[model samples]
Target: MGPEAPRHAYFVPGRIEVLGKHTDYAGGRTMVAVAERGFCLAASPRQDRRIRVCDAACGDTVEFNLDPELVPRAGHWSNYPMTVARRVARNFPGIERGADIALASDLPPAAGMSSSSAMMVATWLALAEVNALEDRPEFRENIMDLTDLAGYLGTVENGQTFGSLVGDRGVGTFGGSEDHTAILNARPGHVSQYSYCPVRFERLLPVPSGYTFAIGSSGVAAEKTGSAMEKYNRASRLLSKITELWREATGCDDRYLAAALASGPEAVGRLTQIVQHARPGEMDPKALLTRLEHFLTENEQILPAAGDALARGDLARFGELVDRSQLASEQLLGNQVPETVYLALSARSAGAVAASAFGAGFGGSVWALIEAAAADAFLDKWIQAYREQFPEQARAAVFFTTAAGPAAFRVT
Candidate 1:
């Protein structure tokens, strides 16, 4: 190792999987990219073997001795960085000669925001900067001359991150390749962008601007490396296999699909069942999409009940949809009687317009999008209602939609 020295800080964004769930692990295309929420790391090199890790939010410190011999166990978020160090060392022999790593994060665990993956990727990128490793001409540099690595470092990091987090011996990098991929940037610390197209299903190509979504959580902190993720991956893989079989049996390929989207309605429906087992509120993407579509198809009482208000030029129906969606989410999608849903319900119950769970589900938070002018009233009412229903989980965050998706920092 040269004495070039290592010292730097990086702010990396969180990733969101808007669509194409379960496809990434199968080497099939999945749409995912970093979001506004993020994690930051500040580091400086240490001459000896030790890692000084810190959590800015909670003011916690963890010092690990960079012990390669030690295997990671459950419950330690630190395992992710260690694991990245391990992989890098495997390639460059002594990449982790000596280093200090300080970490700060705002990403929520098990929120389907890829907090674990973001942390892992942030660590990898940080390591890469410190080592000043040779920049390969292509996205991934092959470890051996005989084998070529594919995709950006984030893709590789994601594969490792999810697989490591979920505990599947072989899930993410199962036959990963680097060809015809939509380019995503790998800024030293900034969020990267990827290609996003209006996925055509039954909905309009350009979704109506006024339309809003609500998300509720189960309030349970899920084990990212435990049964929940594992079950999804397993079922996802099986679905991929079935899609392959179906394609092979019939020469015609599915029209409205990428190599990944072969699992049309039936496939998504089945995936929904599997994901539901893991608790839809907690983000079984497969099942969440299934339920979302199912809502569009049936049990649309809320839309008609409350949304009909918006339709009848009546405000009450809109409020009802908000209230009704929250009730439905609590009963089906996984809002565990927390204040978020109640707040969301309050926004409608107090008469602001439509409300639903717009964030990741399972029990953490809920979202409500209402008329711009009525927003304050809605928020105030929602807060009061939420405080009454669930005293604890009553926190609110407000954000609006904009032109944001995955794109490279410097696209050629």
Candidate 2:
């Protein structure tokens, strides 16, 4: 690539978890997919360890050093780009310079979508590409290098545990599951993930095509996902033990595990009870009890009243899932936000299906799963209700969707 060659920027879409909340990080089950909206990075190599970050939306140029000891803290959006530069230095050791990255994004700041991870992916890709082209005598395009860079960046940027989980290059080529957000469950020592093969995932999850997802603060959610659990080691052990029990029990009979998963199964003989079932609704408790081990294993989608849209062959089915999931998450997980609740209720009154909050709850934005045809009406209703209730603060509940997940493109 030459100076005249265009600099490349990648738009890695953030992902949404359709089912299995609080499950992924706890070694339970989860389902996530890239949302249609996300962040972008335009990069060109620099001659020093300093990466210049021009945040177009915020109109601020945050200049930071790629030194590992001086990593950025969470909620600092520039953390991702800085981490990428630092990790690259730690991995190859050959080229110790940073790059200039200018970014503008549409992904909601703190929804459960993992916008931070998406940013890492784009910055990592851009930096790697720049290195391969410019510093060739000391460079290589080894995917290992990229993965190492991502992981090191994850740790150096997000914290040590995070770097270990999703930053692995091994999973990079294959992408990741929604459960990846479970990295929140990670400790300082290690980050782990589970894999299921012959996966039969149904992806009817809707990504708000033309709209945007927004997150706001209520000042209540202060739990740092990194340090949330005091007995994380014990919890990790318990989760691991329960998972092993399922694997052994299912080794001979998978149906037993499957039936105990989604929906319900029936019919037991008086003499030799033939069915073992997991109760409907939240699957976490049953999983904790080693009674079930199956996750929804599907992508995010809107849920209409009928059923899953993909499973039902209706595009409307996708939105239906979002609507239902929002309600369920509130009832089961306790992550409900008044703002989110009000948004959904109002959206529903204005013709939306459902509305719900994101992340560890208590704060952030509301996601409304509505009929596509009713979007305009819902927005009008939300605006009106928000203005009456919170003249200044309520304006942040806005939501919408954009393009798909991150993928490599041919710049040449």
lDDT of each: 0.43, 0.45
lDDT (Cα, 0-100) at 187 in candidate 1: 23
Give the poorly placed runs of model 1, Cα more than 4 Å off: 1-6, 15-36, 65-70, 108-110, 134-219, 225-227, 230-241, 244-361, 367-377, 395-412
Judge candidate 1 against the unseen true structure and give its global Cα lDDT, from 0 to 1: 0.43
Give the per-residue lDDT of model 1 (tens digit) for 280-327: 333445644543443332122343343234434564544554555556
What's the TM-score of every candidate structure?
0.55, 0.59
**Could you tell me how far off, in angstroms, the CA of residue 228 lies in candidate 1 after the best superposition?**
3.8
Q: In terms of TM-score, which candidate is strongest?
A: 2
Over 4 Å off, model 2: 1-6, 26-36, 64-70, 73-75, 133-309, 314-324, 353-355, 389-392, 401-412
Model 2 Cα lDDT, one tens digit per residue, 98-176: 6777777776565555665666666666666766633443233322343333333334342332322333122111122
Error of 2 at 341 (Å): 2.4
